[model samples]
Target: MRDRGLDVLLVTDPANIYYLSGYDAYSFYVPQILAVTHDRDQPVWIGREQDLTCARETTWLDREHVLLYSDDYVDSELHPMEFVVDRLDEWELADGTIGVELDADYYTARAHQAFTAALPTGAAVEDATKLVNYCRMVKSEAEIEYHQRAAAISERAMEVGIETIGPGVRKCDAAAAVHEALYSGADGTGGDYPAIVPLMPAGEGTGSPHLTWTDEEYEAGEPVILELAGVVNRYHSPLTRTMFLGEPPAEAERAAAVIIDGLEAALDAVEPGVTAESVERAWREEIAGTTVEKESRIGYSTGIGYPPSWVEGSVSIRPGDETELRPNMVFHMIPGVWFDDYGIEISESFRVTEDGAEVLADVPRELIVKE
Candidate 1:
């Protein structure tokens, strides 16, 4: 906080809150903040009275540090930030620049307006967007172990997805089996709910990236894209693969080969002291004259995800991102492309080693033909 000239930091992002305080719950639908300041050795946890037990059970803060407002503040005119501002004033920690997560998914505009308006004369609010997220770019040994376990779950879930999806099978049924496999986990490790649902776009719908499964039956000679993540203790290892129930079209096979080649080239480029965009450049160079072309970024930093996304919102692997690769940093390298009527997705979740990249999952890298 001192480095950024911030006297106080209001941590409102749930993932960031979890990162800081080890407080995890589904109570983020309402207003809450983990206040960090130079005045206190421990961060103060403030939230609704109903979630007091959640804070006490999940966080390491003392009883006095976990404060709660009355039930009237829940979805009423009272507003929780007003209570938060009052507490900050009472603690005498609000008399300087306060850092807030302005772009956080759960920090609403109304909350910000109330917070800023209620601040004391000497206090000011500044955008600290992604400040905590940047701190999470590199994984510790324990965090890396969780990601490795998650990758094992990912491999099992993907295997189930491939085996269950075929001609005459319902897409929803296949998705159910995949979900079961994900939750059941692998290597005796239980899984947590992933940030995203399974993305099983089929045939013509493959052109779109985020489509989920439908109840429709799978057809022969059609391609299906499975993009899923296995989670362990909120850490994710995402994997994507393309499959065909029958003999795939020649164009589809060719596109899949190009994607595989480019993905390998990108993974081979990962090492310490290299720029994020340089790895992407290697992929682009490998597929320069190929019919397959990709405009989106191929990978991003990922770990400790909450609902809606697994990306850490820090470093991105694409052109113009100058963040250098470092040992223990993890990334999900997904090289996917969508065409007019079909798409191909092949991905690997890897950690940057001192020498090169260490791929997390042990899965086949080609489009599976299941005839």
Candidate 2:
């Protein structure tokens, strides 16, 4: 806070709240904040009275710091911000510069207004939305283990997905088998719900990246793409693989090879001194004159997340992103290609090591073709 001249900091992003205070709950839909000050060593977690028990169980904070407002404050004419502001005033922080998350899930407009109105003095609120995210860019050893476990779960799920999907089978049924394997995880350790459900888009629908599954039976000669993650301790190891039921068209095979080659080229460029865009350029150069092409970014940072999406919103591996590669940082390198008729996605979740990127999954990086 001193480095940024922030007298107080209010974190409203649930992922960030969990990052700072380890306060995880299904209550991120409501207004919550983890307050920090330079004067104190520990942060304060603020949430609804109903969730205080959850906070006590999950957070490392002292019982006193796990604060709560009355249940009467839940979605009423008076917002939870009123009580938060009152607490700030009582704590003598109303006159100080408070940093608030502007683009956060819980930092709604009403919450912003309440905080702004409560600070009568020149006490200002600044945008610190990406602050905690940037801090969490690199992973700790323990976090890597979590992601590795997640990757193990993902590998088994992919196996199930591959085995269960075929001609005459319902798409949803195949998705179910994959889901079962995803949640079942590896032996001895159980997996948590992923930030995203299995994204299994098949045939012509593959052009749409986010499509799930259907009740329709799989047709011969069609391709299916599976994009999903295995989550453990909120850290994710996402993977994607495409499969063809029968003999894949010559064009499909060629496109998959080009993508794999481009991805390898991109991976080769990932080292401590390289820039994010420079890595992208390696892939772009690899597919420069090829029939296949990809316009979207090929990769992005990934780790600890909540629902709606698992994208690490902090940094992206794309053109114009000048961020340098750092050790212990993790990413989902997706060279997802969408054609007019269908799409192909073969991705890997990996960690940046001192030498290069270490892919988490042991699965073969190619289009899996089976008769």
RMSD in angstroms, all models? 1.1, 1.4
Q: Work out the TM-score per prediction.
A: 0.98, 0.96
Give the runs in model 2 whose Cα sits over 4 Å from its true position: none
Candidate 2 lDDT tens digits, 1-371: 67777888889887888889998788888888889977777898888889988998899999878888887878787787778788788888877788888988667888888777766676777788888888898889999899899999989999889889898899999988998898888866788888788998888988878999889999988889999899888888999999998998899999999999999999888888788899999999999999988788999998988887678778798999999888989999999999899899999998999999899988999899967
- Sum up the clashes in candidate 1: 0
Worst 10 residues of 2 by lDDT: 114-123
Model 1 Cα lDDT, one tens digit per residue, 1-371: 77899988999988899898988888889988999988788999889898988998888888988989998988898888999889888878667788999999999999998888888888878899899999999999999999999999999999999999999899999999999999999999989999889899999988888999989999998889999999998999999999988999999999999999999999999999999999999999999998999999999999988888898999999999999999999999998899999889999999999999999999999999987
Report the alpha-carbon TM-score of model 2 versus the true structure: 0.96
Query: Global lDDT of each model?
Result: 0.92, 0.87
Worst 10 residues of 1 by lDDT: 87-96
